[model samples]
Target: MAAQRMRDRWKTTLADSPYGVRTIEAIRPVLDQWVDRRHGLLTYRLVQLLSGHGSFGHYLHKVARRETSPSCHECGDADDTAQHTLEVCNRWNAQRHTLVATIGGDFSLPSVVANMLSGEESWEAVVFFCEEVISHKEAAERAREDTVDANPLRCRRRGRRRTQFAARLIP
Candidate 1:
């Protein structure tokens, strides 16, 4: 049953295909290493999600395919997926930059997610990244509201405040 589900989910073409075999083989070493590390709750949860053991992969699929929209709690974007939420979304780029800068290297979404799931990066960094993402999302939302409200005071206040706040927090 699990095998069938995996085949369907990944849209496997040839039976026992080389790519499939290699993907599973690659994942095996990571899984073995994770077991040895005895990761704490956060890591354990991340592993569960990444592996489709729990609802993580399912939820991600739903968001990515637009089957569901977990409104960016911060930016209020109707659609939120791992890619959009982390990479392409301009609203959260500032925060993402801060987190990436802390890691100190060229990093992309896939690398970050892989490092996070493989426990290659410190948990502190992961937690900080999550918090920064959320913070920027909220800032984006507030800015949006200010724009729509058309109130001179709110507009003026947020414009000056956000720039200063971002400068201080980011640099």
Candidate 2:
């Protein structure tokens, strides 16, 4: 079937390719095309954490130039990456404790994926942690952005670049 072929192609591509869902790949190294049995779609905050492309200071400061430093704004830890936020960040201790109580053991990407796949309650717990932590971070980021007058030229250039890139893809 076409779906099977696509799944096979995805598995092959993921095996060799360096990019594309590296976070999921890291946890589930031997990637299998699993069925989505869950009802709800992945949330924005959850996707951001999964993709490592959200309001994390490391990404904002280094990649987007939005923040002043890579250190965590809440805890002052170096490199406020998704992994750091999920696993070790003191800021999310209570939430982390709740997650740990639900899932047990050290919180890692693999564990998250495993627990999420195991049952609905586990999935909800992970989603709750992601929603709480990421929403707070996003709120902080918005507050910070509000205080600063972002450069209009920078925004225009970014839009222009996206348009130019899209144009290149078109015939």
Candidate 3:
């Protein structure tokens, strides 16, 4: 059937890509579930961050060579990473507290992310946390720009500005 063929193609694509089959299986609900459409953009970004398509300083240093240091700017001890942001950053303590309070109690990481991405109950909270992360990073970038730039940097919220360090992906 045509539907079966399409499914096979999608499966093959997921298997060949970075997330692979197992991860595709785990996060598939994030694709099909419709309860969180209001937070779609942020949810998509979160999914990208979780699935290795989004930016993180450690990943940038290790794989992309976009950043000079893997160490976190906020804490200055561990690598600036998704796992660190999600579970362990002291700088994000208040944001994480909000997330925990929204979700109610400690749950396993996978379950929490899954519910955030796919379930109706936690979408708004996840979006808020993600927005906080992005704003926090942007604020840090503005400070860095201020210290380094002879002319004060103007904060722009337009389309993404590509840098020389950005790697081109054919796909």
Best by lDDT: 2
The better candidate by TM-score, 2 or 3, is: 2
| Candidate 2 ranges with C-alpha deviation above 4 Å | 26-33, 148-171
- lDDT per residue as tens, model 2, 1-171: 897687677667776767645574744443441354553357888788777889898888778876677899899898999988999889999999999988886666776777777777887888898999999998887666655575432132347878889889957
Whole-model lDDT per candidate:
0.47, 0.76, 0.61
Q: Tens-digit lDDT track for model 1 on 1-171? A: 885575455443433556434235434434434334544345433343233232222243353232233454445566454444545556666666775665544344435544555554544565565555544544554565467654342243447878878889944
Residue 160, candidate 2: Cα error in Å is 12
Looking at model 2, residue 20 earns an lDDT score of 46
**Residue 75: error of model 3 in Å?**
1.2
In candidate 1, list every pair of residues with a backbone clash: 74-137
Error of 2 at 16 (Å): 2.5
- Which window of ten consecutive residues has the lowest lDDT sum in model 2? 150-159
Compute the lDDT of residue 142 as modeled in candidate 1: 55
Steric collisions counted per model: 1, 0, 0
